[model samples]
Structure formats: structure tokens, C-alpha cells
Target: MSSSKTIVLRSSDGETFVVDEVVAVESQTIKHMIEDGCADTSIPLPNVTSKILSKVIEYCKKHVETPNSDERSLKRILNPLILTL
Candidate 1:
């Protein structure tokens, strides 16, 4: 697929999320739906608000940009500091 492919997600608070298809798939539910051919259009997330979804998208983007770097994982981040102490 082209790198430019994106999927639109609609939040419960009437917010629209137009994000990379990869980023959107971070949500397991969405991923399954996509795999099952249920994501034909804007995926409606009636349970998650825009603010929360925005954060989720941010997290997704970060992980996508650095799949190997565990900077975002709490366990990875805390382990280093804990070891020092």
C-alpha cells in the first residue's frame, strides 16, 4: 500500500481523526475490524472521546516512528531509573 494511505476516525465527541492507516490500527479493535473488511469508511468510535483518542493517536504515532525504541513504554522508562536507585 502507498505510504500516503490514511483512515478517518470519528470520535464520540464529534471529533474527526484523519490519521495514517498504520497509526489508526494501533487500536486492536480497529485492526480486527479492518482485517474483517468492516472498516470501509470513517470508523466511528462512539466510546472514546476526541481528547482521549488524540492521545492514543499521539502514542501510536510515536510507536510507529520508533517501533524498536521502548521510550514510550512505562516499564522501559521506569526500569532505567529504578536501576540507578
Candidate 2:
């Protein structure tokens, strides 16, 4: 594997997260922004709370790391966070 580029994400609570571009693109919205060259600066997610955004990043990171992971596996990983949120 090669070193991947990264993107900066800002949550509604003003928290900033730096995530790999692959992980960041897990969101179609972010993917489009990246494609449109709107990600040169940090992408703002004003609708997402920091806690939820963090959980989302964790999910995306896992998905990127293990692309073959089954839906059940991903769901199991995300269920706890969903219930808490």
C-alpha cells in the first residue's frame, strides 16, 4: 500500500478531523466536493455533531482498511454507535 492523501473535516461543533482521502470519500457529499476541488480547505459538516462525525470517521476508516468486510461486520461495528446516538 502507498501513503494516501488526506482531507480535513470540520464538524458542527467546530472540531476538526484529518482523515485519509479514501476514508473521507466514504461520504458521497465529500467525494463530490473533492472531485470539484472544494476540499483544498477543510470541508465543513455543519449538520453533523462531533460525536457522530467521529463515529462516522471510525466506520469509514474500517471500511477503507477492509474493503471486503461484510455488511454484517460493518453493521456490527456501527450498531453500538447508532444506539448511543
Candidate 3:
């Protein structure tokens, strides 16, 4: 069987998005599901929008695919530090 898992999320506009479990786990709500054994089925995210949801997924995918290990990743992850200075 495939070790990969999928999650279903519902947008505020009534759209459903099927995303990878890893990506979905980026959210605390979904993370809790995995930890509590409630991730076997589609997760209902009634507060999110499709546009914002897509952006979040994109960020998670980028982080998973090419995790910043050196300066670049560090900078991207902590860019706010520069502005705070």
C-alpha cells in the first residue's frame, strides 16, 4: 500500500480540495487530526478560502520539496527579522 496519504478540505465557497497529508498537517487543525486518529477521512475546513488555501498548499509543497538547509532557506523562513531591524 502507498504510504502517502490524502486529505480533503472544504473551502468557504463550497469547493473541496484534495491535498497531501503532509501539506494538510501544516495546519494545527489538521495536525491534531493526525495525532488524534481523525485524519482517515476528508477534513472539513469551513473557515478557509480556496485562494488562501491554494497559497498555503504551495508554501507547504515548496518547503517539503526544497527545504532551505542553508542561508537561503533560513532567510526565507525568517524574512521578518530583516524588516524588524
Candidate 4:
């Protein structure tokens, strides 16, 4: 695969994070934003707190890095509420 692009995400509390496109797209919400061209700048996650968003980003990065991991295991890492958009 070629080098993955990066995406910037802004949390509700104004915290910003730069993550790989592949990792960002792990969230259906972010995937749609990219598909709709709304990610040209930073994607704002107004409903998610910085703390929760950080956890979500970490989870996504791990998921993208480990393609062989089981779905059940992924679901166990964080609260289900945080996983949903």
C-alpha cells in the first residue's frame, strides 16, 4: 500500500488530533465525512469529549494496525457507548 494520508480531528473540548487516514476511517462517521469531502480541513467531533475521543482514536489505531485481531476483542477494549457514533 502507498503511504496513508493523515486526517485532523477536533474534539468537542477543542483538542485536535492528527491520525492516519486509514485509522480515521475506522469510524463510520469519519469515513462518511471523508467521502463527502467534509474532511478537507479538520473534522469536528462536537458530540465527543476529548477524553473519549482520545480513547476512540487509540482503539482505531490499534484496530488498523492489527488487521488480524478479532472483532469480539475489539469490542471489549472500550465502552460500547463510546464506539457508537
In lDDT terms, which candidate is top? 2
**Largest TM-score belongs to which candidate?**
2
Model 1: residues with Cα > 4 Å off, grouped in runs: 71-85
lDDT of 3 by residue, 1-82 (tens): 1228788877777778888877777677778977887656666667877776776666666666666467778568546544
- Candidate 3: clashing pairs of residues: none
> lDDT tens string, model 2, 1-85?
2347889999999999988888888889989989988887899889998998998998787778788888888788778878887
Question: How well does candidate 4 match the true structure in TM-score terms?
Answer: 0.80
lDDT of each: 0.77, 0.86, 0.69, 0.84
lDDT of 2 at 69: 81
Report the candidate with higher TM-score, 1 versus 4. Answer: 4
Off by over 4 Å in 4: 79-85
How much is the lDDT of residue 50 in candidate 2? 91
| Candidate 4 lDDT trough over 10 residues, lowest sum | 76-85
What's the best-to-worst order under TM-score? 2, 4, 1, 3
lDDT for 71 (candidate 4): 67
Candidate 2 residue pairs in backbone clash: none
TM-score of each: 0.76, 0.86, 0.67, 0.80
Q: Report the lDDT of model 1 for residue 32.
A: 83
1-85 per-residue lDDT for model 1 (tens digits):
2358788888999999888888888789888877888778888889998877877777677667767775458456445444544
lDDT of 3: 0.69
